[model samples]
Target: MSLLAQLKILVVDDTTTSRLLLRDALETIGFRNISVAANGEEAMKMMTTSPCHFIISDMNMPKMDGLQLLKAVRTHKVFARTPFMILTGNADRNVLEEGRKLGLNNYLNKPFTPEDLKKALEAVVGRLQ
Candidate 1:
């Protein structure tokens, strides 16, 4: 099977284009189960209903931010171990460090290429199987 087969990924971004681009990249990489959320609140709601194995989220968003969502996920017993990655434009070291403390699996800067996404997924999921 392809590396991405049957892997459910949740992509959270306030920008429609970002979500579309990420989704397309995942599809190109052979990921079949993919979902998108416009903001953290939506992502949280989705998480409660339909759990995903992986999450790629933006740090800055409306309603709720990536950190808040991450904390929420960590607090939830069902999602405590879920792999979460951050895709953001923030370059502040403090912010990155904070995210790291929150247990983010990987952090990718903005304008990331498809290869970057693939690499991050490989890093997070490759170890499992």
Candidate 2:
């Protein structure tokens, strides 16, 4: 089996359209087990029970954002080292630096194509295949 097929990924985005787009892109890249959350809060709750091998989250969200989620995830022993990618329309240097400090694995700028997603995933967890 391809390595991507065995990995479970969590995708968190505030917009439903973005989530669907991300899901479709992930499927195209050979990721079968994809879980989605509408917000950081929802994603955090899901992580308590269903851990993911990788995480792709929107940088800005209500009720908790990507940075907040990253901090929370890092506190937990089980998910501290899980590869994490932040998706953002605003590639703010400060935010990127902060994410880096908190241990983000990669970042994908918004309005990205499937190829962008593939590249981000590749950077975070090696080649999807």
Cα RMSD of all models vs. native, in order, equals 1.8, 0.8
Candidate 1 lDDT trough over 10 residues, lowest sum:
120-129
> Number of backbone collisions per candidate, in order?
0, 0
Give the poorly placed runs of model 1, Cα more than 4 Å off. 127-129
Q: What TM-score should be assigned to candidate 1?
A: 0.93
Writing each residue's lDDT as its tens digit, candidate 2 over 20-121 gives 999999998888899999998899889989999888999999999999999989988988888899999999999999999999989999899899999878
- In terms of lDDT, the poorest run of 10 residues in model 2 is 120-129
Question: What TM-score against the true fold does each predicted structure earn?
Answer: 0.93, 0.97
Best by lDDT: 2
Stretches of candidate 2 exceeding 4 Å from the true structure: none
